[model samples]
Target: MWEVFLYINPLCSFCLKVEQSIIDFTRKNNIDTQYHFVTTSNMETINDYMILKGMKPCDLEGRIGVTQDVYDASLLYKAAACQGNKKARNLLMNLQQEVNTNQRPYNDETIKLAVEKSGLDYKAIMTEKSGDAVKEAVKKDQELACKMHVEKAPTVIVFDDEDPTKPGVMINQFGSETSEEIINENLIAMLEKTMPHQISEPKSKYYTNDSIINIERYRR
Candidate 1:
């Protein structure tokens, strides 16, 4: 019963792991949540933004080198998002893994391979590169990142916008939970407090520092 603004990239294994965990948690617990993934048609620009953020401009394998023009890659991500399909998420996730794990000198074929493995309509995703829908969606995402202060990948927030008296927001701090269990533990309690639902609540002693969220390389 909370609106979770999960800012994540598909390529990040950490992101993938966290996402999978969250999905599992929701299904097992029957929690109502929403995901806001920023990938697909905005690939190139986000990468550029990452480079601008100082990620070495190359994958761990050094396979894909950076280009002066990042338009195509940026469009790849944003355009995929516009399609509003799970395939787009798959494409971005596999693409991220490809760049992160592959060897150096990544080229068109490797990218194509990542796309194929993701089970997306490669032709459709490619065609979307030139379409206005993807371009506009990418812009919107960028603007959103700016407005929402998401400067890092995998930015997660647990929020409820129903309170009317104070009706503000409670931000979550990352790295607060001592362990994975603690993370889920605290999340359940917080969710109940915000939505008052029947769920397995975590121990609240975890809030010693009174922080439930963390901002990683994310700046406003």
Candidate 2:
């Protein structure tokens, strides 16, 4: 079993990309996995993320002025989680696609469309999204991010089933152009590092001189 904490900024392009990658990774690996998301509370972390990726502060300031949008989207994501994990993931991906892929504004209309696409209970989601409990949930996510020392959006921290107290392996700073395959590779590598026993060795008919050759070695 694995526990993955994915910290994201709803408005971040990199976050959207990594979100897809993480989804793909989870499906392909087929390990018993529980995943969670932590949303950014302020623009400071987003700014820092972009700057670390070589964005000039002056240019970035004008582009990422939608702090309120981020907060609202964060709340919506938390509210979506109340329904179920799958539905929440659908809503999150749909929302990101609308804003990042379709270039739609992250306003009420876009949010509504995303919720509809996700097959979510729109009225219930909206009501909960505005409640203090949802707001507190979002705040708690941010606090968890801080505790984990997450410095960038789209960061993934993977914990093995062995020790609950360990900090876990952190996967971060993928470039905007990073492919899902590459991200998956990184995830697998981290898993191997953290929980080697969980990874299955490929079976083969032939044996090496010393021992059976690992199928993974051929592609290396």
Report the number of the highest-lDDT candidate.
Answer: 2
Question: How many steric overlaps are in each model, in order?
Answer: 28, 0
Local distance difference test, candidate 2:
0.70
Superposition error at 38 for model 2 (Å): 1.6
Error of 2 at 54 (Å): 12
**Model 2 — which ten-residue stretch has the worst lDDT?**
204-213
What overall lDDT goes with each candidate model? Answer: 0.53, 0.70
Best candidate (score: TM-score): 2
The parts of candidate 2 lying over 4 Å away from their true place are: 42-44, 48-56, 59-64, 163-167, 197-220
Residues 1-220 of candidate 1 have per-residue lDDT tens digits of 5455556654454455445656677677776765556532144435643553357545643323333223455577666655564666666666666765564234567668877786656677778888887777667767766655555555555545344232213323334322565546545655556556565455355432223333232222
Q: What is the TM-score of each candidate against the true structure?
A: 0.61, 0.78
Q: Report the Cα lDDT for candidate 1.
A: 0.53
Task: After the best TM-score superposition of candidate 1, give how far the Cα of residue 196 lies from its true spot, in angstroms.
Answer: 4.4
| Residue 70, model 2: Cα distance from true site in angstroms | 0.6
